[model samples]
Target: MPVPNRPVRGVAAGVPFLAVPPTRRLDQPAPVVVAWHPMDPPRTEAAFAAALPLDGLEAWRIYLGLPLCGSRSPAGGDEELMRLGYEDAVMNLQGPIAVQGAEEFPAALGALRGQLDLGDGPLALVGGSMGSAVVLLVLTEADRADDIAAAVLVSPMAQLRPAVDATGRRYGMTYPWGPASLAVARRLDFVARVDEIVRHGQPAVRLIVGARDDPDGFLAPGQRLVAGLADRYDDPARADLVVVADMAHALAEEPGVEPAPQTAPAAAVDRHAVHWLRRHLGGTAAPGLGAAGEEP
Candidate 1:
């Protein structure tokens, strides 16, 4: 059955909220939406701290709400992507950390550091598109390098500058940016930083992509990152890639590899990620809210 398109209701304040069933069983994962609706004001480290229940928190899984700039896919696809039902609780942020003009990348790291805590159990990172970029950025932090247990990156980009270049090439032209863009680019190199962390922390990393995704850019760079990981660890399977046959960017199938049922590709991606996470975290499911989107 097709996942029904549910109407998103916004607060009187205009922030989009994740609508979930009110009553949940103890055995089932609790759903929380940390959505950054387009209209909400920017957030700060203190704001992030206020939103999270980090006060002597026990076991919890943290799901960063990193939304792709242009993709409409709902964050993490509800029950489908979280098939293991391992999360007993979830922390959903409204969106990526707030940054001023040209401050997006670095400030984003600061926001992540303020909100992320390994807690008392295994922590897993999941990101799609730009959100994945944020995940990679957080892992690169020297102090936080060994904290994450595993990561799932979907349609990921390896660096801010190249991603911008890729966007220009795919869309047929480049736009102008101030010095800030260059600064962000120099500081955030996803592939290299991830490789550095993986060499020392050895966190299990999984890269999921659409075979023909952003054909001129996204796919090739992701493949290169995987190859680089193999070279760094000398184990091809340590950081592997899974290309869903008919999936497109953000797990949508508009530009599919082949004509598949509407749900097959996403289901396949979910299965692989959940299974790998299970193995990496020693088969113990962590707690988390089910989904997220760019906290705006």
Candidate 2:
């Protein structure tokens, strides 16, 4: 399939998104894959789309901006985000983003369905770092959990406690885990809620981590998630982990708020994600084309 020169930019239910339609399926209802970006490089919807455009895949790739990110950032910008992390990374930052992002997804999806030629078929999800937490929350808690066909997580925050601790270690400060924070941690901890994901549909889940990501925070938890889901999957291969060499936590260079040229590591991630989505969503389709405009 030929790649589009640019993605169709739009807002759905107040969420900014960069959408790329299937190259040859403008007349048909195409499979849709909604993605969320990490807090690191390729942090925004446009940037993530540039990094992992999923070219050649016969699906609509819609990259959505996470809460308090991109156009939704506070007035103080990155400084405000840092302050929130310093105040209480879990309660003030990570926890809220995951919860809000998950909560807002259904309305965003519905709006996108109304605005685009999206299929009613099972959806696919992709997320990175903290964004992955939102994806897990959706799988475990969303009313449409059973409508998920596949998911791909990069440097995922599968367990929240370890991630908070790891952040503390990196910044040389200890996070005083209190009752409220602990409760948030438990709620965001997807490892402990594997049964919920399995109860829904046990969608094909692929976790990709960089070789240099924090071992305790990201790598180990991702591995644990795959292991937890192993027995639950009828085809064990549906749940697996892939470690990319020469890659770190962030997928692109610094100042990842805007769209930029893709990095080597990001290209590698794109390949893995595209392959996984193609394999899983290849045969799926929407019943009819909606009001989405022509491909860009």
Residues 193-220 of candidate 2: C-alpha lDDT, one tens digit per residue: 9999998898999999989888998899
lDDT of model 1 at position 60: 32
Tell me the spans in candidate 2 whose CA falls farther than 4 Å from its real position: 1-6, 26-28, 283-296
Q: How does residue 115 of candidate 2 score in lDDT?
A: 81
lDDT (0-100) at residue 251 of candidate 1?
Answer: 46
Worst 10 residues of 1 by lDDT: 37-46
lDDT of 1 by residue, 27-107 (tens): 322222121211111121112212221222122323222232112223564342233122210111111221211124234
What local lDDT score does residue 123 receive in model 1, on the 0 to 100 scale? 56
RMSD of 2: 5.7
User: lDDT of candidate 1 vs native?
Assistant: 0.45
* lDDT of model 1, residue 214: 70
